[model samples]
Target: MPRSPHRTRMRLAALVFSLTLLLVMTTLGIIPRASSTTTAFSFASAGDTSTLTAGDGLNSLNRLAGSRADFFLGVGDYSYQSSMTGDVWCSQFKAKYSNIEIGPGNHDTGETNDTSGTRSYERYVAGCSFTLSSQVVCGPVAGQCYGKEYYFDYPSVNPIARFIMISPRVFNVTGVCTTTCNAVAKSPCNDTTGCWPYNKNDTHYNWTASAVDSARTTGIKWVVVGMHKVCISAGAESCNIGTNLFNMLVAKKVDLILQGHDHTYERSKQLAFNSACTGFTTNSSYVLYNSSCVVDDGSRGFYTAGGHGFLKYAVSTDRIDIQTDFAGTYQDSFSVVSPTTSLSASFTYSPASPTIGAQVTFTATASGGTSPYSFDWNFGDNSTAQGNPVSHSYTKAGSYNVALTVRDSAAPTPNTQTMTNPVSVSPTPLSLSVSGPSTATTGSPVAFTATASGGTAPYTFAWTATGGSPSSGGGSSFTTTFNAAGTFVVSATVTDANSQTSNASQQIAISAPIPPLSASFTYSPSSPLPVLPVTFTGSATGGTQPYSFTWDFGDGSTATGQSVDHSYLLPGAYTVTLTVTDAGGQTAKAYQTVTVTIL
Candidate 1:
């Protein structure tokens, strides 16, 4: 059938749209593409070439390298004797596998007498560059660098997947041989004195730090650090020095540390330790995914045939899957954890300036994270405060520094921590006053009152008396009783809501009762007759003031003075009673025995 022009143009437009969509999806990593799959790589340290055959190791690496692998990582020790053997090994290595990236090993640098080994090795391997795009060499040994000890970025998978190469002997300082060499004699090349320089001026350590810092600044999500020394393993001559470099890796939070020194394959848990402490006891465990040390040979002798192998690492967006293979046999496998997404949190306390005893409410919120999180609060007063929307009351008056650390279960550790400005708890004076009965009699009731004026709301009152009961109340008044004759002191203590208290005391005197006087009467007549007046006298004693006495005779006669005389009206004997009264409303009664006889 003949297609119309208009229909043909529409079909072409649709095809263009489809291509554009495919391109966009690929760039966004949303499309399932062949390149999207992880790219695998292998690394191995082919030790001394004397006993180790490069052909066997190359064969093992070839079998381990799956179709997905893009390149290979090699650490020194390529050949034995001189750089010529090393060249032969390299030529053989290239002839067998076209996708291999080689690095300089100790043996590849030729013999101690060969001065041109370094330059020749560099020229031979310069053709095979690193797979990473951002590979750059700097410092004193910049342009002449090899792929053995360098850093690069794999942008096809992730622009931030940084791979750092480390040379075992790069940072070490060679020591002078005392027996065979003079102190002033320059150490022979390829010997310990020529390769490893431990001096601080050595650019290795500084350059390494700089590389790590640069990768961190670039927001690199994962860092794969490869070296030729096994520092974290159980046994190795350079284990301690390797530990120092390991400490640096931990400080930088590098995702994975890869190295080969011990000729055996071993793995470890992520290691965390205090750099300040040199001992292993101070080491702590971090969220380490996994670690492995691969030694192709069981014995230290590098010439062994079956001991050659390589490690295959599949780098993906999420994780770095690893598998170790020897003689084409899968020995062990593990993976590295992905980096956590960073989050930030900020805390804002309402009523920024809170007075002493005021309730301070805090609200902390996090950004760049999913909902449902936890918070840890440090009130900075030797006390811990916690909660999302937490509230606290400050009793003491001072500047309280508060910190909020926010975290979520998805994160490896706390995502964000913020310290709020010093919340000043201003000092408040508690005005106190006492009011009660100023004077009271003995065994009388008295009330003491304590009033406070300045403080926050919900004031608390505490009353303490030195010689009385201590009570607390919301109001300012406190009542008590005074029972003794001596001067009784009453005290009242008042406390506000801010927990501020004040005390006041008052003294009250209770006067004792005065004793009353007693009066007695005597008759002067020797003989008493009917209707005869008898001389009667009364004496008063023991009284506080002038005594007024009331005397009552048996015949209904009475006297109204302190002392009085009474006469008998009848011949029969009569009873007389005298009553005395004091100034303080006290009275005493006395009776005298009188006899009337007929003459």
Candidate 2:
């Protein structure tokens, strides 16, 4: 189900050259570059690939494809079997993935050429195309264009990352020694021409250094270098990529370094190349162990191990996540986080104990993130609002968890922060009502009662009236008397324990005071004789109703009723009196002399 690996490698090599030209065109402003907008993208990296005939190699490939990466970085060591080109790896890979970017390895160019007179390294470079969002750039040297040394900026414009691919220890198979031709040797080897090695003086090393510096000046957030030889690994492969390049990358603060010579998967702890860690030498046996330069050890999720897998990178402006996975199974993972502050939010609301139908004002405050933040609220009553300061009212009173979610304008995706707090809604507000007689007589004491209800109990009342002595009183009940007879309003305000208040007023009608009582009396005749029958009548007014009368004749006798008859036995001038008493106990008297002698 595959074609010859040789054909695949040749095509890939041509593709790399064409990609280099594309990058050059981009540099000349011939093509449109990416905008400042930050977009999330992913890629997978691995090397030492074998045919998909069986084993973990095929599964690893499937896993890389299934990851749905934007591109695949072939770290090198393609077609481990002899006579096979890159078809065993590329045929299935190209069908599954969108693009592959090659970084040449020693094995790719060590052996003899194929029947078509094409080297595997050259074939790989020509076969794999560089079609990622990043712009590919060729090496500065005239001959070093593809499969030798190159670099690219991911997301072209305002790029956050720069990837430099180089072959530090690579050699072409020569006809000097057929027996040892397959073996990779250092410069001045017995079989072939001198190989390109990793050192400060090497062309590849110089290009890599320049690329790293340029990325920093251009504001790139991350720099990753890809090579085929092992610089530091748990595998048996020596540090063939040289200590100078490794130290340079580390000192420059390169974020990640990927290589493929070692078939087993291995990742290092974050190491520093400062004076504390000491510098690495050209000794192949040197390895870093228990060094203070380890900024973060394999302890907090960052790991170091040996296995068969690939590294998947999910890159964004704020962070880069790396996962070592094989056939859908992940073995190790770590994150390279940006130093940007984390987003956080908090909120405060007015009327801590709000009643039903009361408007609650919620003001949200955010911090530690990008500017131009958006706010949203969930009132827990199935109601929602947006903006920094929002208002909401609840129909029913109860406790609810109010949530405020704030989003900032961070690149790739907006950062979000949410905060929840409990709000207790009061059942009802404090109310007061004053009740008394609707009509009252002037100068009479009127009893006014005030009733208060609702709101955190233990309420107090303040009574006030338009016309009344002691116009203000405290407590639930108040009494006031109106001196004048007119319509007066009596009001009472009740305040609950929470200091919430409500008022109610009542109108009272006061009439004028009653007049004093008076009494009058008259006899049937203008003059009456005591000897004869005398009649007297009494009446009263201006006091309460139901009057009683008492009549005293001059003959020294008394009678009770409104009208009375009396006769005097002796004829003499006597005093007669009539006393009228109203129901209110107000008495009035009237007197007259009766001539009873010779009438």
Candidate 3:
């Protein structure tokens, strides 16, 4: 029966649609993915395993399974037996841990009498490809990964760590050195047999460098390298991993290096190449010739030669702690922490003392830890903002402790640093009070002073007056003379350094000057007797002109005019008083005594 073309087209269309949907889901992160953050996680690692059917291998597997690890790393040499296939090892491993990563060991490769297909290396690749199906392969060829060299990021989505797996000298074959080949492939032909020197320009070296550089550029907090052969170890194993690779790893500041080949477990101290030694020989017989060349002589653990144990790693954003569980007993432990986790934060604000309702800018800076960093600001006024360089305004005057917290993009737990600074906000003080005489006579100099406070210092005063000479003046104090008598107003405006202005005004009264006025009177009746009229005369001078007078007799008689007569009806003695007024409203008084007797 011929297949229906239309049906076939529909099926193809459906397949395309499904694939597109899946892609969209993955891009949007709607699909479940792995996570590798600064968050803490644990894993187990080991190499050179015997078949887990029985014996020490089973015990080690049991210990690793009980480790409560998120994943397991098979460093190399699975099943020790060259005839054992990789799938068989994975079958036993999968029962314990579903997530696993593997790097090939010498026994797993075509070394000695073992051939490529027969060795467990090829089988391990196939098994791991299935177990870790989502692993990203970056080998020289497409899908040609996990067998010899490859790299993967944990918790693939937004990973915080990268694991680089490499096989340097796993294969021993007859081949000329090439830049694209592993160390053994580039090994020097020593008389066509026996010993072979390392080649610096090899596939593993170049790939490792590129991988490490990429991880750094991508801001991966941790870079871990895993292999099956030891380079610089306290164990009896030769430095088969090559010298150039070791130095490169150290120079790159790789967080940790995991390898397993020797039957005994060993760990090297934090070592740094002094550049004293050019290269190290890979032969087992080679030993350190100079004590100065050794930075740290690390310890070794001979867990009964073929230890039945695995290494457990507790990893965090900044540190990785490792411990060995061997023969049901705790053996070795060490810690490897990244120095980049030291984080410090600081912030600076403009306008040291801000005024209420004015904007203040805060810029934050951080040192150490991985970036792209995040800034969180607590403006100290119950307000919050995020991001570097933020602005805020205070609604009231007070002292606020502004806090800035900077967090770096580290996984499992980002490095956080908090810093606090006191910010003082002052109330607006750009007001002024005009003070001077409220009443001044004509031609009198009246000092008008403007007193200002707050809103930044260095206040300037501008004075304006009405009905006064020199009506405008500057500075805090101004003096002006009033030329005419009237009710006038004095005003001053003060401006502070911040360009804030305030105004004040005072009403003043001005009058024309008055001259001295005096009043004198002469009485004709200085010795007048009772029942007689007393005559008085008054005159005045000074003050504004045209004087008027009034005279009063002490015995209750009063008279008006410049001169007046007053008589006491009955009195032994009588007093007469006269008052004079000038045009300017000035007044003066005079008094006279008269003796009055009965006629």
TM-score of each: 0.41, 0.45, 0.49
Cα RMSD, model 2: 20.0
| lDDT, candidate 3, 442-511, per-residue tens | 9988887788876777888888986678989898889999888889988999887878899999999988
Stretches off by above 4 angstroms in model 3 are 1-39, 116-120, 130-134, 172-203, 266-292, 295-306, 328-330, 340-345, 348-357, 366-599
Which ten contiguous residues of candidate 2 have the minimum total lDDT?
Answer: 9-18
Which one wins by TM-score: 1 or 3? 3
lDDT of 2 by residue, 1-599 (tens): 13234322111111111222222232233332222234477877777666665556666666667888777777776775566655445666676665788877666675433223345455566567567766678875565565567888876767778888887766662223333444445345322453566566566677788889998998888887777776554446666766677666655656677776554343343322234655333344223222233233343334544335566778887666765675433355545554446899999999887888889999999987787899999999999989979999988878999999999999889999999999998767666677888998887877788887767778778888768986878776777878888899988888888789898988999998778988888887666555577778887888888888888875668889998877777767778888888899998888888776664
- Displacement of the residue 376 alpha carbon in candidate 1, Å: 20
Q: Please name the candidate that would achieve the greatest TM-score relative to the true structure.
A: 3
Best by lDDT: 2
Question: Residue 315 of model 2: what lDDT?
Answer: 83
Clashes of 2: 21
In the range 1-599, model 1's lDDT, one tens digit per residue, is 11122111000001111222222232233422222245444333233222233444445545634434566656444443343444455555556555555555443443232333224345436544454444545433544355545677665444657667666453211222322222212433233543433123256666777787887787776676655544444343345234445555555566665554344443322222223433323335322212222112233321222333555566765555555555533244444533234577888887777766677888888865433677888776777777889888776778888888877655454355464657777656666677776676544456767666666555556555443433333356676554556666665666666577776666767655444466676666746666677666666777767767677877777877644555675567667787777776667777765666666
lDDT of 3 at 481: 92
Each model's number of backbone clashes? 18, 21, 11
